[model samples]
Target: MTGDLVTGLRSALSIRFVNTGTGPCTDMVFTVGLPPGIVLLGGTDRVVLPVLAAGRTHVHELTLQARTPGPFDLVCTNFSYRDENHEPVRVTGWRAGLSVRAAPVVAPVPQPTGRLGVICETPNLVLGAWDELRILVINDAGIPLEDVMMAVTGPFSGAVPRSRISVLGPGMMARFTFQVNVAEAGRHVPLTARTTYTSGGAVTRTQVDHLTVAAQPPVPPSPPPSSVPQSILYLAANPRDLPPLRSDEEMRRVKERLQLARNRDRYRIEPALAVRFDDISQSLVDHQPAVVHFSGHGDRDGNLGIEDNDGRCTKVTPEGLAALFSLHSRTLRCVILNACYSERLAWQLAPHVGHVVGMRSAIGDPAAIEFSVGFYLGLFDGHPVPDAFARGRAHLLSRPGLAPEHQTPVLFPPGPSW
Candidate 1:
């Protein structure tokens, strides 16, 4: 006997009767005894065969439904038949256990209401950045919708979160955000968002959107020989709305540390103060610097604070920064986000830049300056990016009252020998 006896729902059990005698058998009867909590759905408890030919087999199947979750045994209580010699024979000893698991709770399907709508919102999609994809589910009917499900399918890098709404009232809508990362860049990347709900009956709505990925910025001509000595572009921003940062002091200390290095002639620092949002891209193009450093304010969400047109604080997201830096990957070797809560930004920039340094948590001005000095000192001594990051942390620990922030600085991609 064989069956899918171990299940949470309905199952099937089959019994096989084989005649191994040289001649045919007659008057064969078989009975199955079922344990408690198991019900025979549509089959009888016993089966009888009028005649069984020699070396032939017959199968009887029983449909069973488990009423409770437990282990139960199905046994064959009786098996009697007349052998070819007109002799009666009885056999017993057929038992099988069924382990029934508890059935999962399923929500009831909602009744159809009126109409359902799906809307997809896609901002500027950039290659190799975690971009946001927003989906809105709207109930246009006059009734409520229960168990609304939203799913998205696209050429994304990782898993996309599934959105669910238990109830959506009439004229109500729910918005969901999906962090999508795509590797390929093209003029049009197709994205589809599907939403299922009851609108009168089961209704499904699909919204398709084409996303255009921006290409990398073009590289500008090389700077003249006079600017060849300047390889590091230091950008500092202090907007009026946000708390003022000691970026000037940080820049000054960095210049002094680099000047004192044994190979000072091989490197030079170019400072851009009160950096505006637009100036970031222009500076990279004009200087074509090997190293780009930003000292400013960063929010917990990893948005860097930069100057707007009116000299007010403006925010730049990590995704935007990653896309912008990708354009300079040909010439840029490393990036240092010397601001608080920049660890996430560092990770985003790692794919494009060879090395990146960021702060794991909020850092005070003194620690930031000390780290910048130590990091530059290491670089001047021909230490690689990771080693220089360690040097920065060591400097922070050695400073008076700054030891607590020693682990604030973090390096991405641990090893970048260059």
Candidate 2:
């Protein structure tokens, strides 16, 4: 491997295969296995060579990009070939270690007004990924500002329209977070933050920041098939105070679809009924599932409804759920939020989870059930998450009276490559 090893930067990995035997090797295959926190920028991880004569050497190079800042190992998980005797032989135990450093932070320039300072913290975004853009408003003047309001403009925007602060005291700072969707790659996107405040008089100020979007990272190679079944944690909640939902029917449909799948043996569904606010963490810790499915209610404010201690409806904020999911990110592959107005939570969870499926608007019971059934069928048929999402939408479109809600379900970082 060569090049600077840094998070958000590109690097190169080189693999050399040598044949020292008396005869030539045929049908050689080499597969590179990437650890968590590392992403392949381009090219396929698996390489094949038709033939390699004795005393011959072949080299393969791959482009890599690191996501998290830490140490990771690159292993040759599989290497095999047929020898002169026409017998298949396998080789393994090849590994390389790399250390990736965090990207350097650039300091924001002070505003010319000198009364108020605005700083926008932009992140390196991958194409089609959802990320957060933070803006810091500092009161540097001797006087305080009242009725402070901030509105963001540009490619990145918040789920809600604007952010406001009642009052900003002198020498104090307030931070604002906005969820941004990266649509284009290999270009710089500009973001403007407009601030309005009331001091001795009303005043308005604007600050701009530019973020560069890198090309989409290659989907990591699939791991070798394992004997252990992939666990799906299905959580259902229908509090007494909220309208009734067909939670049981959804579970039954999901199980029936999976049972008829060709790869039914590769998946196991674990249900947690009457889920309460506290049951989420315990279920996750106990099951350690690869995929999580939540069927319940959601409010317009993007809060998910769960059961309270008294069996009443309780709301869970997107921030809280995002933080909780981040803790188990290494093992969690995808999350399905099958509730009304759950797109905001999908944006919040995108950075922590691989793929997220959420409802953009209110959907009926029949549409939701059909989407889930089709989604699980696609997954069992060996399709990627994005494709499965399309299959789910197709299910809605194909059914009578359900086509109107076909656009309700959305996949974050919408891309076929994912």
Candidate 3:
């Protein structure tokens, strides 16, 4: 019986009849209909009834194929021959009730084309702290999603109105800006949302987003604008730059090799997904950074820096560096030169940014990666960058001897804040 209902399904069901009257009958009829919902599979009148002699008591067997899940009532009619007079008499009252959980064939969850991939930008948070976030929902599917409703909790824990996200059509993107104000900070806040999408019928889902907003220290605001706008920029010369390990094959092999050698996650590799430098926002350029990492070559004495093949100098000049400061973001604090000779060039622009890191000598790829790995782990993982720099510099320094010379970071003094 179970095999008859398809494999891996709870196919057994029973509907007992109070009476299956004995009869001198010609035929029996069973009638049924689904209780509700579209029938995924059974029918009421499906069983085959055998011919019955005047006093024969036999079973009418039914093998059902339920099309869907619902409650249903079955009716059985026993029609028999009459007493040698005129008409056939109806053998009354043969009915039963059934509850079928015929599971519908599960369809694959379609890829959200107008997908609003819910992501928690902050991985941790404190109570009473606020997290500024932009929700990115992209419609990458074939259909457009409208009137999307969701219940958001944790970071946005409040009885707020269902934020109506506008229509996101295929390949288009829509952003919703919301702030999660926390009463406390440093705790991991769970952002769970149940989205109700009305695609003719309805599909509901709950997804989780983890956020951490640490208790940020209170800081003083800038002492009134200087009336002049300052600007800065981070030019990643990597127009077509490939990350460590050269070609794609080589990179894959090396990553595999390294994974086997040691757990990079254990060592805390701050793997920043590489993006084109030009893709950087204009606003970011307007806000000068405390540190800047130039991942290319620079020469101070030559007053020249290398550029990508497209001719945008991978290497920037002092004037170019000054030009970088002209954007609007001039609160530059420190610079980490993942490039060669950048430290030497930073001597002239010393006051622009604090703490300059450059190769006192020519730096190779291995050393650059080593430093980046150490520095970011230290920065993002709660360790002060100075301590992280020391640790990284020590790792290379302890290697017995290699490189163009001692690959040390040149420190430039900070203008104000440390």
What is the C-alpha lDDT profile of model 3 across 1-418, one tens digit per residue? Answer: 1123332343434433222444444444444432343232333444434344555554433445555555556544543434323345565565556655655577665545443555333323334545554344555446666666655555344554245564556656454556656554443434555555544333643344443333443445868744342221233443334333222232233344334532234221112222233333342443444444455554544243443446444534665554454342245545566666665455444434444555655666666666555554454444555666665565556566533333455444312121
| Displacement of the residue 1 alpha carbon in candidate 1, Å | 21
Residue 80 accuracy (lDDT) in model 2: 91
Q: Write the per-residue lDDT of candidate 2 for residues 1-418, one digit (tens) a residue.
A: 5446778888776777788889999999888898987888877899899999989988787788898898888888888999977689998797887788899996653333455666553324555667666666778765677788877766542353378888888878777666666565553565556777766444554434333323344358889988999889999999999889998999999999888999899889999988986799998899888999999999887899999888899899998998898788767889999999998788778766788999989988889899999999899887998889889999988987999898898886664421
lDDT of 1: 0.79
TM-score of each: 0.51, 0.51, 0.32
Cα deviation of 246, candidate 3, in Å: 5.9
Superposed Cα deviation of residue 394, candidate 2 (Å): 0.5
Poorest stretch of ten by lDDT in candidate 3: 266-275
Error of 1 at 320 (Å): 3.2
Candidates' C-alpha lDDT = 0.79, 0.80, 0.46
lDDT-based ranking = 2, 1, 3
Q: Which ranges in model 3 have alpha carbons more than 4 Å from their true place?
A: 1-235, 238-283, 286-291, 300-315, 326-331, 401-407, 414-418
Ranking according to TM-score, highest score first: 1, 2, 3
- The TM-score of predicted model 2 comes to 0.51
Model 1: weakest 10-residue lDDT segment is 209-218
Q: Per-residue alpha-carbon lDDT of model 1 for 142-221, expressed as tens digits?
A: 67776777767777788855687778888776776677777666645666666665543456544333333332223367
Candidate 2's C-alpha runs over 4 A off are 1-223, 415-418
